[model samples]
Structures are given as C-alpha cells and as structure tokens.
Target: MGPTEWTAREEVGVGPWSGEWPADDRYDPDLLAGGDRRNVMDAYRYWRREAIVADVDRRRHPFHVAIENFQHDHNIGTVVRTANAFAAAAVHIVGRRRWNRRGAMVTDRYQHLEHHPDVASLAKFATERGLSIVAVDNTPGAQPVETAVLPRECVLLFGQEGPGLSEEAQASASFVVSIAQFGTTRSINAGVAAGIVMHTWIRHHADLSSAW
Candidate 1:
C-alpha cells in the first residue's frame, strides 16, 4: 500500500504563497509555495535550510557536546536533538561511525557534527580548540553539577546509558559531575541527563535575555 498522504505532508504550517515572493534569499521557494511545517521554529519558517543553519551558527554557544558511542546507544540521537535545541556549538561522536538517528527528528541537519575513532582523539580535538572536557556521570567523587561552576567554554561529554563514562573517558576529563537524584533509579537516561546538564550550564552561563 502507498504511504499515507498526511505522512508525506506537514501537518500544520502556512499554506502556499498567494502572490509575490519576498526579496530575502534566505527563504526557500519550494517551502514558500507549499507551506512550511518543518519542526523548526517559526522564525525559521520558509527559510532555506542552509540559511537557517548559518543563522544558528552565528549565535551558537561556545560549549560543545560530545558522546561516546561505543555500543551504538540509541540515546545518541536524543543528545543530538537536545544539542541543537540548546544551540550547542557542535557535537562530537566518539567511537562507532554510525549511530541511530531516529530520536533526533531530523534536527541533525541544522547542526554540525564530527566523528572520531576514540575518546583519545576526541580529547585531542578538545585540546586543539581550547575546550576542557567535562564528563558527566554519577560515579563516586563526582561533584554535584548544581553547585559546581561549569566552564562556559568546554565540551560536555556523556557516555553510554548503562555504563556511564568509561575509565579512559573519566580520566581525560578536567571535571566530572553528577546530577542529584532522589529516585530509586541507579541512573538517569543519557538523553535526560544531557538536558539537565545543559540547562544547568544555561542557567549559569547562557544569556537568557536573547532567547526566543
């Protein structure tokens, strides 16, 4: 059977342009003629994909996000999606080249991503870019992220959901932090963990006055 028409069409957005087009080159002709219902914010509606990316790049935060993908963890896609939502400077994937993107909902298209074979290589990239490696996990001796003064410019690293950060990944970090938990769960999901940490960073560092 053929795919459902609604599945192929955007559910809600502006309908086709009725007349003259705008002068801005950033607007995609196709999107303008056929309503733009992309997952993007309304400010970016009808904008060319590259144009939206360029705008995001110009305003992205200094911090970068990195994740260890040793087991092809499905949560990696959620991390990418959150990174995009938070306007992270970039995302670095360490380990397996291929990852599950089902959770990202296509947001990866607007973000910059790099892949490295191992954590060591990711560390090298951090060094070259003057970014400290801040690892996140609930292991012993980890500082509570709520109180710790997170670096404004650094790479926030997360490991696989179950194992958390590996030894090598932990040793390479300039600082390691754990989120406070009252629940009985041993640990939180990687995707949820990433959001909490990112929000903490945002609270301490990001300029809220400019946010939409």
Candidate 2:
C-alpha cells in the first residue's frame, strides 16, 4: 500500500473476537479475544508470537547477516529489521550486546539474533558453522558485488555508517565486495547496503515460486 493508503499501526489489524474463536493451537487465545493489532501480516494476524517464530524458523534463509557494532550505529536496527524481512537465518551483532531495537518494529522477536564480543569470535563462529564470511565494504581490491558471485550460505558482514568495516573485520572476510555507487557519495548507509547485498544474494539463490 502507498503511504497515504497504509493504515496506522495502532489503528490497523484485527480487533477482539466477539464470537467463538478458532480452535488452532497456533492461535493465541488472548490475542483472539482481545484485539490482535500487532504489526504482523494478515495471515499472522491472530497467530501466537511463538507459533509465528516457529514457522519462520522452519523456512529461514540459509545466509546470515552480521553488523560490526563497535560504534553503536543506529543502522543496526534497520539491518536487523531487513534481515527479518529477508528471512535471514540470523542477524549477528558483533562488539555490542545491546542495540537500539526501535527500527525493528518488533520483527526482532520473530527473528534469530546473536551477539559476539568481537570480529574474531564472529569469524570463528562462521568458520565452525561452515559459512563463508563475506564483507560489504567499498575498500580497495574488493570486487563489485554486482559481478561477484556470493556464497549460497554466507555471513554478510557490515560495518558502521561513517568509518565502514574495521581492518580486522575486513581481514576476517573470505571475500569483500563493494556496492557500485555512481554519485559523489563515497558510500551508502550500512542499513541500505545490507538490504542491497541481501537482495542480491536472494536474487541468485532464492526460489521465486516459493514466494507470493
């Protein structure tokens, strides 16, 4: 829906049931009885939060998204939210255990999230999991993501907005690809970059017929 056509979060969604409720276990009795105006899709309007998470987990994407949060970037929330939208296996936050979650719009509750102390730990985790570490940075020697072949199962690493990826983070990457920008801006926002990279991976690997 367009911006003007979109319903306000507080004003949209289902209201409390006035009659008999559905017998499905996935349906939350409280929600069904008392207005489920959550910011969820129509199919999940009255579904239990736990049930929704279980369903999402069952079909999550193979790839993961990670952000080096040494700077406490607000973009991390947007990245996490986008990860949830893309059905990423998980969103990894390195160097920060606590992040601002306002931009996630409660989607974080349905997505898997992990926190690592540093880039090294994150690298080790990816290595042990057999997932490649692919960094997104506009640094030299990096290939253009538009041409580079992304791994089917990889951790797409990102750094903060201004400084970009740390040297160690770049070193930890098995591959680093930059998004092509024609404008005078040296780089794009980490959140926007993450979305672009994830969608690129999806374009190459995801089955379109599976999606609506």
Candidate 3:
C-alpha cells in the first residue's frame, strides 16, 4: 500500500458512547464504530487499541522524546500525538507523574510513554542507553537547530511553555538547540516546537526512500 493508503477494516462512530472507557477515553466507541475522527493518519482508522499499538511498535524509531512536565502542561498531549505520528521510540515525562492526554486525542495508545521523578533520573536513563540529550530552548549560548548536527539516536527534550527549560534540564542536556524564528514572539508553541525537532530527526536519520 502507499504511504497514505491503508486498508481500513470498517467504519466506526465518532462521538459519545456508552459504558466505561479508557482513562483518557482513547477508545471512543462511537469513533471506533464509525471510524476515528481525530487527526490520526489513515493507517490507524477503526483498528483495535492493541492492534494499532502493535503496528506502531513494530516500526518505532530510535529517538526518544522528553518534555518537562513541571506544570502538567496541556501541550504535552499534543506532543504525544506528534510523537505517535512520527513513531518515536518512547516519550519521557519528567517532574510529574501525570499529564493531560486530551490533546493527544487518544493517540497515546499507539505511543510508548515513560515517567521520571526528576531531570536527574531522566538524564541517567539516557546516559545508560548511550543516547545524548538535546534540549529545545533559545538561550544566548544555544546552537541553532537548523544548523546543528543531530545524533542518529538521541533524546529531544522540551520544557514547559513560557518558563522554558529548568536549570537541571539545561545541565543534563549535552547541548541546547534552538529553532529558528523571525517573528516578534520569543518562542513558538511547545507542542509545535517538538514537532519541528522530531521532523528534523526524521529527515536526518530515517530511511524515507520507501515512505511513499
């Protein structure tokens, strides 16, 4: 099949339904019955929860995604969705144990998520795995992401919107990379920023010759 073409099993509903559901209502019966209405790509429409997850897992990428959850950032959900879309190896939630998944629109099921008590623990995890940690922030000393050399395997770390990366996060990152911007705004949306970084990794590391 083509990259955008998928053999859908059936049509599912896309609205409210009966009975208890997953914690994040990821498995919307209505959507599952009529087909998922969320922004997921064609390959995953109306598939069973486990089936979608298994498929994503089969082609998972080597890079990991980490976002600082100090404020329980709502954007984290959107980041998860993007990670799932790009088939990231895993997502690391730092600082908090729980985060809002509404933005993910139930796509988290197809993404692997991990939690760390603090930045130190997260740093340790990356170190043990031999994966370098790259923080997304625009500081005086930060390297331009557009020109930086990204590793084939590494963790792209993001901080909460507004506050940006914490001292510990900066300390842990091997280097900080900043996305280029010409607008008056100091920074872009955290979720959107994550998407740019992830795509950059794909362009550099992933084999896209068979993508179509």
Best candidate, lDDT:
1
Candidate 3 lDDT over 13-35, as tens digits, reads: 33333344444343445554443
Question: For model 1, what is the error of residue 15's alpha carbon versus the real structure, in angstroms, after optimal superposition?
Answer: 1.6
For residues 1-212, what per-residue lDDT tens digits would candidate 1 score against the true structure?
Answer: 11112344537655665567788899898887777767888788789999999999898999999999999999989999999999999999999999999899999999999999999999999999899999999989999998999999999999998998989999999989999999899999999999999989899989899798
Give every collision pair in model 2: 16-35
Output the worst ten-in-a-row residue range by lDDT, candidate 2: 1-10
Q: Each prediction's Cα RMSD?
A: 4.7, 3.8, 7.1
**Preferred candidate (lDDT higher): 1 or 3:** 1
Worst 10 residues of 3 by lDDT: 1-10
lDDT of 3 at 179: 94
- In terms of lDDT, model 3 sits at 0.83
For each candidate, the alpha-carbon lDDT, in order, equals: 0.90, 0.89, 0.83
Q: Alpha carbon lDDT of residue 37, candidate 1?
A: 68
Q: What ordering of candidates by lDDT runs from best to worst? A: 1, 2, 3
